[model samples]
Target: MNYHLFKRAAKLFTSLLGTTLLLSGCQSSPESIVEKITPLNPASDVVPVRVVRIDSSYQLQRAGKPYVIKGAAGVQHFEKIKEKGGNSVRLYAPAYADVLMDKAHQNGLTVMFGLWMKPPYEKFDYYDPKAVAEQQQEVYRQVQRYKNHPALLMWNLGNELDNHYGDFKVYQIVNETVKMIHKLDPNHPVTTTITDGVYAIPSIIHLCPDIDVLTVNVFNKLAQQPVRLAEAGWKGPYIIGEFGGRGWWEAPLTSWEAPLDQSSSDKAEFMQAGFKMTVQDQSSRCLGAYVLYWGNRFEQTDMWLSMFAPTGEKTPMVDMIQTLWTGQKPANQAPQVGAIRVANKLAQADLALEPNTDYPASVPATDPDGDPLRVEWKITRDVDEFHTLPQNRTAPETIPGAIREAKGLNAVIRTPTERGGYRLHVNVYDGQGSVSNNSFPFFVGVLDTPRLGIHMPQYRRY
Candidate 1:
């Protein structure tokens, strides 16, 4: 579990530099911004969902009511998001939009509906008239199918189209599709997402005027957004398309090259700082923010980014989101690993492991709410890459036959044949949907050389 947020503290420096390069100009005064972005629409049975730009500020309104998108990017957990005071969910595709819309509307939440667009790095050619026409037809059909859903807020056109892409024609296609979306669904504004704020360039800003908002999915570089937007010189509104814990791309790597990670609690703490600095800054032009990957999936580690575990249990990151969105923590607290010992030693420097060795470890943990705790252990080889592009997304290689599971609170872990860097990870679940994870990194060295006396051999040489 994440005992603290001290691991990879050096990475925070890089986050600052990234932030400075992205966002620069001071934000407009709240009074001036508020007055500039006030929606012209009066109260009515249904206020059109739209982005209003008064001067330096923009506001999203629905039925003439002010709405800030406390949204998460996930299909599951609509009820949880709403209960946690989030007003929306951002979907990556329309595959389950029909069902999601029905559920989100029932839960008194809106949806930032996403339309999947193929990135140009793939075989799909945006320059081809036939391909573009066929894609536009598909887009039209989907828009026609779901434009009337009450839960629909805005049209998120694509997710990080700039990633691994070289052709600027992609943006041209986006301009075309957004223009089409506006024609078919005027009630909702249209937007597109980039991997980070740095992609919000002047060309994208000027090229797609039909696009209302420049949404960004920022991980550790979140603090750079304001500066990035200012650097882009775009005057339109923006939204945090995806954010939460640090991304696998930017985290520190182990000696063997695996991404060093934060505990669940530490992820929550970094998230708190990120939200406070960017999305929660009311005076800034940020329209709203969406937490990334609401459900669990393997990304570096199972617990690396997902707010929920595979069993639908929430991690401390989830609680942090609840507190940020609702101004209060959840009723249940996650289990905390007070100490993790390898070979009865808590220090990494002291726990020197040898190849083909078996080692004993203990994860002493406690639950704040006194709930029964379940623990799991995992070990993986560290890798050499600190960051990855979209095309290069992958988890570190697992050290096979490495962990021998013990009954409780401990395990007998097997070391790899080759010496390098590896980590012992522990996850503690409180069964109340709260969990904490901790990872202990250790070094593996070669077996010691055998020594023998050579007194007889020296006499023979003479």
Candidate 2:
């Protein structure tokens, strides 16, 4: 009887909560809410897709008009990419194109559809004559299905085809495929992504003259941008198909074994700096760049997702991207820290100073959007000078280090050690990934003299 009653109660509670949520949802504006919750049915709204070249200088026409290609790789979190202000996606070939086209259209994002071909890199035979024919057939099927979709931006013939195998026969096949695609659909441009910008194979370039654009994947060595672009000499629009921090191949020899943690704040700063440098330096020749892996993939330990989780919380880098791309700040603002105070028992002054004392410092943050704010505390020491106590670790190491749904603007951080001077840095990140930082410098002094009346027996004997 008790078990049955509990089950009934649970069902009743769930039903009531569902009804309340439904009612609350109904109160919001219909259009805004519909955009958020609308389900996409691919078959429901398929339209004939057509691409018309605007102008050879389309990018030049839109100069300073925020002509940035804020996109991610298709393998990454697609839905999350759209939610995080990504306007385009780069996905691999024929098998994945249809579904990706539907999703991109639904989210109002563009797709750089990649053609499927495993060049000899992974033990695939591109040299086989029959294999080449089959691959062309696959490409035609994909083009026919998605060519009319509103989301189809451009079609990429292959990814890094020039990396491993140097077979001219493959280039001839690529040329033939491009010719076929042009014959079928002259609306969209066809191009292939290459390994390096500077090392363009003459045979491939001369063979694939029908190819509309040239794409290259560049990494940390963006300083070679000027030289690489000059070397290509394609006289056509180009894209930095892939550009970000060092890939697994580009890491230093000593730290090769140490799996890189791209999620760190330092990495974020490095990416932002590199991006700025590349854009400012190579704007003339570069159309736009796609920051790799908009979502996470396990390859080389999930290097590219701007946010940690796909459907979960965002990382600080997301906020940084928005700032870089849109030049807009988050709706809510970060808090400012005015000052910090420290007290210790040990001091050079006459007053009684204590050792191993606990000192409390107050921190405050604010939000402009009136949204609720949270405070995350962190205390770090200079690795070269002093060793930090167990409590002075990163947020993950400390208990309840990150506080969400916090009521007050101010929070108190406790100091565990009373010894050396330390730098206290506080990071306040809102639920939306907007962050602000504040730091304070403090030192604890040692007591110089003991109580006058209280004397040791050993000292008197001496």
Candidate 3:
């Protein structure tokens, strides 16, 4: 074999292996180096705006009052959907312009109208001259037609084009299209949503100069958002154009493989956590985010849309989201606590409780906005009496009050009682009718070893 050919073959093999790892969802080498940079800290007193164009940066005001968009995909529900939280709806194409604009106007919700482009990821062949003229005409027609709608929030130039191609020609087309739209509708800004993790900030900034805000679709990796945004150096206004738990691409086919069916509980957990992480943690320059597939009948996996079945029974996730966005905990629902652990051990096993011994236990909880979470602790020799504790301590003494800070309800239980086997139980109430109780058995062995003996009488006494 030629020596040069062998080296090239080796390089090809390495590249293929890396791609395979990425597609297989295995850990791959980090794509870019992370550098420490100071995050922008907006003034504490600044009032949040839902969609405000400030200089070059767009600011989405944090929902002043809890607002939930009970929206559906398509132009059908424009007039009927109450949009309890905030009045907002997203429209996909010019074809639905009259229906959507009229319905949104009547229903009192703002619209994020998308400017549809041609099929296939490739750019219109500007060199062909015919393609360029066609694109310009199409763009101008769209800009002139929808510029005067009061429901319009921002103009979406395209949807998910970044995943298919990265040609500068496409960017140039988009840049020109945005410019035309701005000229026609200068009152509204331009935006476009990309498939998650495909577009780079620098490339768009350099190529698409007329674009105003950046929107991205994210699922599953919502927790790592701050780091991802910082690394991408996204200085413009941003929004989670799509988020929630398992998108069609994310969910597994069977529970045996990886709990892929997306249980109601799991979906609820995802919405709650995702909202807190995105809106609460990164709301400074972050504009509002939209949950994906608001109302599409996806034939492929039949799982991306947010509506219920024929009977119209909303999933637990929907109910959870209503509470989160509206800040009105349901009257019958409460926080749920699960995955409880004690001393780094699973909570199901027995634990040792001795004087001066630190009995740390972690209790994870989820609350569907109806009632505030109140955790009650109880300890007794008889497992039957585990519901009642020594001092009837129901309120949190040391637990972090803020849900974001506690990392999901972890606390250390200090036993003042003497050496003995005891059953410990944690009862969590959502103040609604919903309640969850967890129990664990622990043995407090006598401190016979001198090294482990309690020296202070106060520590030894129960």
Candidate 4:
């Protein structure tokens, strides 16, 4: 999950950054900020969203008051997001836009509708007049359709349209589109999602002047965003469009080139720390953040980047997020996980593994609430990256008949006979619906797999 937000701790940062919507040069103190700004638009009314300067900082203004976007990139669990103290949900596509808006509105959550710009990926020439006109019309339709919705809060013009791309025309398009949005929907502010790199800010500053806020879909360096942007000379407001731990491209991989995924518990710590560093700590100019997937999707494996499991069960990541968002702990906490071991060696394919052989694997984990832990085991082949992209995403396929036996925190798994890279997936449950998911990669082949120093470039995978 990449979508996220932080509205609960508004009081905590309001003192430090002055009040939201307290125009920088206004002759008022923090107490006067509310009186000057908090006007009401009652009865199903959605006031325009704006990014206002508060002296040296910025805050998002909604309904004539400060709004912290405790949001998610995914749309599932609107009720749960509200229950967990989130105030917004980002609808990423045009699919059932009105329906989602209704759900979010009913749940008392705001919506940031995302309109994707995919011309570059499809190789549609940016300079083509007919194509540009068609794209603009499509965007216009979306804006005109949902601009008046009471649940609508803001707009994400494009999601990560700047990774390994340098057309400059893309920035021009984003600028033009954002300008159009401001005129058609003057009430809502417009933001565009890009990769974590600050290198694109110069282009954004030069071309996309209408962008009110910059949304960075970040990984690996979640806490450093504000510092990086300031160094790159972008003084505008921003939000974390997607913060889902580390990217698969930046993950640690085995000698066989399979990535090592985090246990659910470890992921919890990582995500919690990231949220604190960015949303809670950097609220001066940072609006809020969105957790990547509120639902489940395949980035590398289901367990690699998702907060919820396929069965709608919550992982430690969710538990951690709930704790941060609401300040209340769950009755039963998810288990904390360590590494999986095979024959006394870490199950990272660092040792020799032979095909068709049955090996013992044990998981290391503990529960914070002293609950009993049960382990479930499954075997899956490594993801076939050849056929996977953001548009054509794929989860790892389970290999039937590979798991021979499963017991408490341990399993006897038979290596695949095909002699390829495989993973032993483990799920540790605390019996109270809380879980810790983890996996390790192992090669089924012999020494034919090279021991050469592996070098995987860190690319931004959105």
Provide the overall lDDT of each model, using Cα atoms, as 2-decimal numbers.
0.72, 0.53, 0.53, 0.76
lDDT by residue (1-462, candidate 3, tens digit) is 999979866755654454455434522211111112121222331222245556764454333433333333445434324543545777777775776676777787777778876533444443343454455566566656655566666778877666545443456557756776666556667887766664445677787866777777677766666567767776666767767665534443211111122433456677678778765666665666665444423222233344332223344444565565677744454345555566777533333445655656776667657456767555544321123322342322222221212222566666544555454455565554444444444556652333222121221000
* Candidate 4, 229-271: lDDT as tens digits: 8888898888998887676777765666666677777777888
Kindly provide the TM-score of model 4 when superposed on the true structure, using C-alpha atoms. Answer: 0.87
TM match of model 3 to true structure: 0.56
**Model 3, residue 116: C-alpha shift (Å):** 0.4
Point out the higher-scoring one by TM-score: 2 or 4. 4
Query: Which segments of candidate 1 are over 4 A away from where they belong?
Result: 1-47, 337-353, 360-366, 370-372, 380-411, 416-423, 440-462
lDDT of 3 at 95: 79
Query: Could you give candidate 2's per-residue lDDT for residues 1-462 as a string of tens digits?
Result: 699878866755664455345435543222332333322323434333332234543242211243446776645567766666777888876565557677787787777788777665557665454455556666766666665566666778888777645544456667777887776555566778877635455766677787766777766666566465666665555666876555544542111121122323434455677667655555654556677656544333322333343334444555556666777755543333233332421112122223334445455455555556665545433121112222343321232332222234344444434454334445555566455443443333543333332222221100
User: What ranges in model 2 sit over 4 Å off?
Assistant: 1-68, 75-84, 259-263, 280-284, 303-307, 332-462
**Deviating ranges (above 4 Å) for candidate 3:** 1-83, 122-128, 252-259, 330-462
- Measured against the true structure, the TM-scores of the candidates, in listed sequence, are 0.78, 0.58, 0.56, 0.87
lDDT tens digits by residue: candidate 1, 288-376: 99998888866666677788887888888888888999898778888766557888876423344888889998877788789998888
The C-alpha RMSD of each candidate to the native structure, in angstroms, is: 14.6, 21.0, 18.7, 11.8
Best-first order by lDDT: 4, 1, 3, 2
Ranking by TM-score: 4, 1, 2, 3
